[model samples]
Target: MLVYVLAIDIGASSGRHILGTVENGHLALEEIYRFPNGAAMQNGMLCWDREALEGHILAGMKKCKELGKIPASVAVDTWGVDTVLVDHQGTPIFPMAAYRDRRTEQVTDKIDQRRLYALTGIAHQPFNTVYQLMATPADVLERTHRCLFAPDYFHYFLSGVMANEYTIASTSALLCAGKNAWSKEVLCMAGIPEHLFPEKCNMPGHILGDLKKEIADKVGFNCQVILPASHDTGSAYMAVPARDENAVYLSSGTWSLLGIETDTPVTDEAARAYGFTNEGAYGGKVRLLRNIMGLWMLQCVRHELDDRYSFAQMAKMAAESCYPHTVDVGSNRFLAPASMTEEVKAALREENKPLPKGEHDLFRCITQSLAVCYAQAIRDLEKLTKKTFTSLNIVGGGSNNAVLNQWTAKATGLPVYAGPAEGTALGNCIAQLIALGEIPDLPTARQMIRKDFDIQEYLP
Candidate 1:
């Protein structure tokens, strides 16, 4: 009998429900529903529409039922760091603030970045939950009964269960270095109450509970809600089909997270100086990665042009153009820029570099700069981990860009294997499969992925 699993993989810009099945030692996926997701200006702050997202989740489940493919279990994975605070009555007390909101900027400035990194082993990001919580108003904090990360909140919505999943919680900058528990010292330092979080954190693959009766009746199906590394990057890393320990994984999407998997967290001064973060991975591993500003630059550029050109068209133009201008793609100035084109031009002018003349040149500049940044990150990873990685596995939506893949290969001087564009959903499904006994372990799941997906290779 074939068993089905559902993966609700939500990113910063979009969300999709994928129904997956494992048969004949291979995995297959069918996207049941997709919806646009973005932070919108509300009450003078950027926030997520929790109700709309909840409605879409129910609609997707109903669609699955209509297709006669009710999954044996369901899991959700989303971008990390953003969270919502629920009151004693299990009601959200404030709007869900997005990670891009500037409310935490002042708070970050007040905290000691180096000390915070030593405590949490997470790099300093202005949008981290630690900063967000510190910026919360006193009245709001007093009423907040529990603070749940994005995926945890959604899982709570489905099962009425309140618990933080380990992987997502690791991104909070509140979890202690090399530990599965929250850091009381860090919380106290930030003046965040200890009671704001769940009493305990659950590891990935833990079955939280069955779907609530109300939701089951509405969707016409009842299944366990399993935790799948609830952080989207964690799930995406789970889908990397690496053969051995000598492989580096890049979960390329809105953010390009490139790093190696390690059994222990890297919390030394060098790691911190390199801006590397130690996030939890499945089965008690640590993802020692650096977050590079990825396609967001190109995304902003496309948006600035009112999306006059499709991504494919831009990629083709970038491949043909001969622009040599490059800027630090990871700079804070590129984050939530008012105008990406103007920002790039400004940076070029300041550096006394040749300015991009047209759309093609601008696209080329972004792509080439990203590849260079990736190469630098790879060098840093090797130096920190003391491991030479022979291959780079590029997974997620950004892996679909052949032009960028080739440039990455050339820049890094390493062979690149790019495929499984739906890596987050695939990894989410695999976690559900593991919980359902359809797969034995992560290594076996990766082997099955290798058999199922066609990975295109680019040589240096």
Candidate 2:
């Protein structure tokens, strides 16, 4: 029998449905649909285009049905920290906030950082759900009965099930990263009522149920709707094709996450001072990493410019252009700059730095600065984990950036291996495979991946 799995993997920038099949001990991925996703400002706050994205996922599923292939199971994994609120009847109560909203700017300072660090062991970022919910007004939070993170929301749409997964829930400062439940102490201190969150936090792959009868007839599939490491990074880590014990991972995309897996959370002040987070990863491991300002800078600039040039063309020009110096791409100005190009130029002027004169120079500056951040994060991970990584693996869309890959090698002084550009989908499918008892654990499943794909090696 042919086992087909439909994985709906959506990121902040785009969404895709990948078909994964296991044949002769090898894993194969086939793309069926891809679509764009973004946020919009509504009534003075940034919010995700929920309706459009929801439609995108369904359309993808309907496409799979048209091909007459019943996917074994369907699962969703999206960016962490952002969630939607629903009333008792499971109807959305308020618009979902974009995780990049600036309302959380001062909340981090107001919270007792010491107590927070002790509880969650995750860094205080302005966009964290903890900060966002704290910023959420009394009326909005009060009227809400259920909180649904991105993936769980999709699961509800598919199986009529409602539950929160551990990984995504951990991203919200609401949970104790070490203990695995809502941090009541932190919630009380933050003045956030305990009932605002799910009463129980379920582990990944919780069998919500089979797709509802209407959905099954609407789209034929015998599989159940499962949660695959609800955090996209968790799903990606499940598919990390590392062959050595000392390999580190870079799940690069809208945000460049550089980290290593650890058995326990790093709660000491050293890890906090270093700006590393103890985020959730596969098998309940702590991901000690720093999230870098990534392609958002370039993407924002492109959006503002209205697609004057293609990405490949820009990269070619960026590679050809040379500059006297680089700008601080990590600057808060680049975090959510009103104008990326203008901000890049302004920062260079402020620092008495040489600014890029052309598009190529600008693109080169962003890529080089991002690679340096990746290199620094790798160093930080090594220091936090007390392990020397043998190889550097890059996955996700940013892995396709050849110039950035080579520069990451030169900057980190480590062997850089890149590929599996569709990691999120691979992770999603693997979870469905597990849900159906097609495979055992992550290691054996990853062995199947190694047999399936060819990864590129770049040594410094």
Tell me the whole-model lDDT of each prediction, alpha carbons only: 0.92, 0.82
Report clash pairs, candidate 2.
246-390
Q: Kindly report which residue pairs in candidate 1 clash with one another.
A: none
TM-score of 1: 0.99
List, residue by residue over 147-190, the lDDT tens digit for candidate 2. Answer: 88988888887888889988888888788975578999888888
Candidate 1 root-mean-square deviation in Å: 0.9
Error of 1 at 295 (Å): 0.9
Model 2 per-residue lDDT at 238: 75
Clashes of each: 0, 1
